[model samples]
Target: MSHMPTNIPDQSQIWNGPAGRAWVEAQSVLDDMFSGIAEYLTAQTRALGARQVLDVGCGAGATTMQIANVTERCVGVDVSEPLITLAQQRAVLADSPARFILDDAQVHDFENGAYDLIVSRFGVMFFNDPVAAFENLRRATRPGGALRLVVWRSATENAFLTTAERAVEHMLPDLSRRKDGAVGPFAFAEPGAISRMLERACWSRVRFEPVDFTASFVLEALELYMTRLGAVGLVYAELEPRLQAALVECLRQAYAPYTIDGRIRFTAACWVICADAEA
Candidate 1:
């Protein structure tokens, strides 16, 4: 494996460790959970002439394979070796044209002006310095190249996320102040802040659209679901076994209301953003 540059040590450790392995194991489940919005994002690309495509934060090669079906050349890059390994395996098994690499998009030296379109699903929010990270991304794109991404809007707006977070925080004391600019799923929740970063990166024609969809999580039981989650599982791992059991019960109860026809369903909201490199 080639050296992958990462500016965030904590994030690098987390993703390359348990979090990445968890995603690889739960890849299919995650695909089912997020495929609705992911497919929606891809559907919007019919009008674009994307011969070469880049899928940033592409986990397990699902989105990369999807893009490869349409584009001449496609590549997916991620910081997680396990996920990248799974992605590469899937690509090889499926005889896909998409290429997978383990690298950080924030600092990787992508060939300049190589990609016609760049897309991400719930990616691009983990950068230690978002503006600088995006500036690097801008330099990777050709003039007038388009970039599209789907990012969680906010914790308040996404019940699927907030429910679990609320339940966890309610059971356990607030661990930290959740320092601003910390890399997490909700790092780019604020649309205005993300827009300013894009502007600073010198991207033009930037736009954000709210996308709402019913996200489904298939689990035989809430206990199974609880164990499969990476971050939450890590949090639960710290507690005594008895406390962990209590936490699971609380999460199950909190999730009960969202179960529809025996499937866990929640209203998920995200910002579908698009922009063009300076022409």
Candidate 2:
């Protein structure tokens, strides 16, 4: 058997180290924040009771397990070993047949018509080349199969994100001027741009359903800031040792207004897109 790249360097590799652990530790926060995006896409495109499903960028296999609960078999793919490690452990503990693999979805080899459905939760946006990536997905799905995908809308409408980011930007002014793509949380939010990408990938009858969801965050201000808006983490590291603690306190204050009823209520926009596989 060939080995997958488990020790790649760069931001891509960071998802498997302490940074990845930081992200993993906040899965609940993430799930709470984005669960609706996954469910919305699943509901719109699932095959009533899909026999076999593939979850791209499965990220600890949360959405993958959901499909496994309703379907026969599921394979969750991600590029990070730490994530897949957690995913495999979780699958074993859960006694789920959901197989977790450390692999990149963009160009992974698979048999044609091997899967009945393919799904993602804000994962399709990270591909270096989505056109080639999705064309591979098309080959993986059986004829007349379906696809379910979710993607962020735009940065402006997501008040929670913007408000939280401001807290971090105060510490690091550089982020405000950074380009909006290939580094930030989302690179594809333009509705027209997404539609065009799908057409290029050979997806037909694509349906983009706009969905809004409330993120009920239970963490305190500083805790929430670190886990959710970790841009503060980056900037804090840049400052001198004496400054980091003070900046964190400031961020807590900046995010205080969002807290209510013992939870932070934030809204986000996403699209639940569905399409059919090729002939």
Candidate 3:
């Protein structure tokens, strides 16, 4: 039996559909772009020395496998079946001890007090009711168990993200602002608001530290980025061929400032949030 909530329909649809599939297809490029921050988050999780670990929103199972190397037990949970399928295949190929489950962490019925640590990388931002979601996670962790997750600080703080958005906005003009800002990548951008949500969810010793790292990605040109990396591909999909070409040009120019040594390198700002389950 599984406990999956019905409140997060939007997220379920997006993560299980084309958006999720895109991530699966470009896992290598995306991983390269986020490699530095991902390493930092996984290292922090390993430092916790938790025997039982739960990786929430463990996309493609990279962090899950990394932590599994050091932990006695580890499980990765995600909403996207396609991504989970890839994760499982990789785990099998590597003979990794980590288990990957296809389920939404927000409502999945994890055994009470089962995990000694919970971690995420660029996850935990899409919950419709974030407080409720964290409460669910709280119930799954043992008392005093630690949580260490990394999330983008803001869309404006991320040049790689905003460059593409701005490029498309130059072409489509009307696509500048998202109708629901609280649903996408920047959902947890507001530190104060997220802090309040965690406090209301009964987490203790909550701390947020801002970390900025320069991420470098191998790319022959910015067109590769526009077509292969991030949600910009979705935006490109919505365009006519001519307009897509135009957006590509716009992105190339926008990305020029970040290009060095024939690679795209930009500073990404993120928050490393740490909290403890209430005893």
Candidate 4:
């Protein structure tokens, strides 16, 4: 196991703790939610004709395993121990050739020129120092290797993810304090900024493709989903009971407009980013 770097201690703690465990428990739902994106990524990997591939922040190994079926070798790297363990178990159960490592990609010691392609799905956005992380990934890629990533466009564009946060904003004033360039999911929301960051890390020919889809959930499970796996869920357990109930009600009303025939659907807006390793 690679030592956890001090720079990402908070992230390490979050993923290794409740967030990791939650992902493990919700792996099935999460997989279903991102299935379309995973398929798109797999198709892109095949199109690239990559033999050895790397999946960064490969939570529960869905995309990694998908890539494995089309590649000679696929390795998944993540910092969350619980998520990594779950991914390993799933891989073994499915007899997949994918391998996983519980290590931070930011500072992991990857072999130089080992991979022909690197891919991620809604990952690679959490690094404290994204430039340093991309530089490490660049070192692991062969000359002219390709990189593909799917990242959220913005909170407003991804209402499926931010509805709960917005619903409870009055209660949690901090939710409205988001800014550009923060080291979170929306850190790469700005295309120009991220393109420049990747270039600084020595990746070339960066480009972005817009991806829009609907994320659907059974209406019955909406509340549980929000309180358990959503961003607001991170702090849901600490709130007073009255506040919690109020939040649940707020979310219920907020999501009502999106409900139809026992299901709730919200738009998911993301950017499919592509780049090349410096030759």
Candidate 5:
């Protein structure tokens, strides 16, 4: 359950986007989210080993720096210029050889197997054309290399976000109608859409596993996080302030049931798909 890579009508419109300012306003929550994400990538890298790793959406380079610590080469790609700028700054502090690229879009240019391992945290779901996008990612991997990623599962399984959304639907206009933002949660929300896409892109032995990770939401802090970044943030910006406050209140109550021992307990399920190139 995340926002899409926005392709605004013009460059001048970039800063005006709802999610554009989310990075700064929601830094604390994002920091917490990235902490858990870094742990996930660290485990994945230990399994994949220290090699070439490409982070598809390296927001602020938290996980990217972690991968760079172990891998020989790391490149972070993001659509947000502001975020990329921050990532570069952080890279300087970490002293990691990670390069960041800012592009309005991602395309089908695997560049004929240029990477060894490709990774994304909660990225990859919002691409313009996922089949073409995965095909390009397949092209980027060296033969026998791997692709690893995590994405939101269906609403039935992720009540943490779904319940929040349902509670606030009337407060804000339906963001689902935005035509541009990828549909909520898993864009490939269907059962086998992931493996099918990979197979079509020349990947083999694709596998999907359930990802059950807990997320915490400190109501005051998380409210800032939810309405400030990416698509969800943008939707919050579109609403009237009074409605937005009411909406956040609704979420507070909705999410209260999940809080355990002072920490929120929300679990996400994803198909941790892995595949090797044809050897």
Candidate 6:
């Protein structure tokens, strides 16, 4: 049996439940959405000449397969069973050397000093005890190994993520109870906080680089995509049919200013962080 992450039970519950299923259903779309970051991380892995690679929170195995293409050994680990299953299925279909494990990375017993490169794209956040989780990850990495992570910079800066919520906020229940800077998508938005956490975890040479890009989606698919996942999606579904229709129209009108040539485009603000295991 895999080692369960006691410190991240809530996170595990979220990922292994509806969130996990939703990701599995939209694997292709999500993969395409994050392709650019995946490509960049893969290139960094190749450039570093990493022989053994571990992809943290490797959802759907997209980045793991990409790294496997260039590295000798690659393993992808996640807490989401559905996502891991989909990733394994994808690996088999593609004949890729990547392997997927359904386990909590925060506590999983990864081979000590086994990986020379650890990477995550829009992962590595959501750890209830981030310092402890990163320390565990550091123990799995070889001395002098590289760690690369791509995370959202800030919710305020990423219009693509918040526009829909803003559009339909009036109809939804008050979400002020939601926690921030603790465990969630934007947990590590502040560079200083994340840097301190990594340093305390025994990682060295930390650096952060801003990566701003535009995300484009087909106008016709925008509603379905936005109404299918995330916090907004969850509450949006509970709304009555009449309100739901109104919300969809509200979203459409709110996004109208961002549409260009039949495609809805918005900015995605993120940070690509790099660090090294203490040698």
* lDDT (tens digit, per residue) of candidate 2 on 1-279: 222223323545656655566656767677666676666545643544568789988887778876777777888888778778888888899898789768778778977899888888866665666677788888899987888877667777665566545665655667543223343445566656666767777877888777777666675533644633445544444578666666657766776777788877776776667788767
List of clashing residue pairs for candidate 4: none
lDDT of 4 by residue, 1-279 (tens): 332235333888889987888788778777877788889989998888999999999999999999999999999999999999999999999999999989999999999999999999877988877888999999999998999999889877776667787778888886543444566778788999899989988999999999896676677677767787756877888889999999898989888889988877667798999999867
Sort order, lDDT high to low: 4, 6, 3, 1, 2, 5
For model 1, the local distance difference test gives 0.77
Off by over 4 Å in 2: 1-11, 17-19, 41-48, 176-184, 221-229, 235-239
Q: Taking the tens digit of each residue's C-alpha lDDT, what string does model 1 give over 146-245?
A: 9989888776676566566567775677533232344677777777777887998889888998888778877564565575563466566567989888
Taken over the whole model, the C-alpha lDDT of each candidate is 0.77, 0.69, 0.80, 0.85, 0.67, 0.82
- TM-score of each predicted structure versus truth: 0.91, 0.85, 0.91, 0.92, 0.83, 0.92
- Model 6 agreement with the true structure over 1-279: per-residue lDDT tens digits: 332235444878888887787778767667766777788888998799999999999989999999999999999999889899999999999999999889988889888999999899877987767777888899999998989998888877876677777767677757332233646677778899889989988899999999885566666667767777667665666778998898888888887888899876666788889999978
Find the 10 residues in a row with the least total lDDT in model 4.
1-10
* Candidate 3 steric clashes: 0
Off by over 4 Å in 4: 1-9, 174-178
Candidate 6 Cα outliers beyond 4 Å, as residue runs: 1-9, 176-180
Better of 1 and 3 by TM-score: 3
Candidate 1 TM-score versus the reference: 0.91
Lowest summed lDDT over 10 consecutive residues: which window, candidate 3? 1-10
At residue 149, what lDDT does model 5 achieve?
79
Candidate 6 colliding pairs:
none
Q: After superposition, how far is residue 16 of candidate 1 from its true place, in Å?
A: 0.6
When 5 and 6 are scored with TM-score, the better candidate is 6
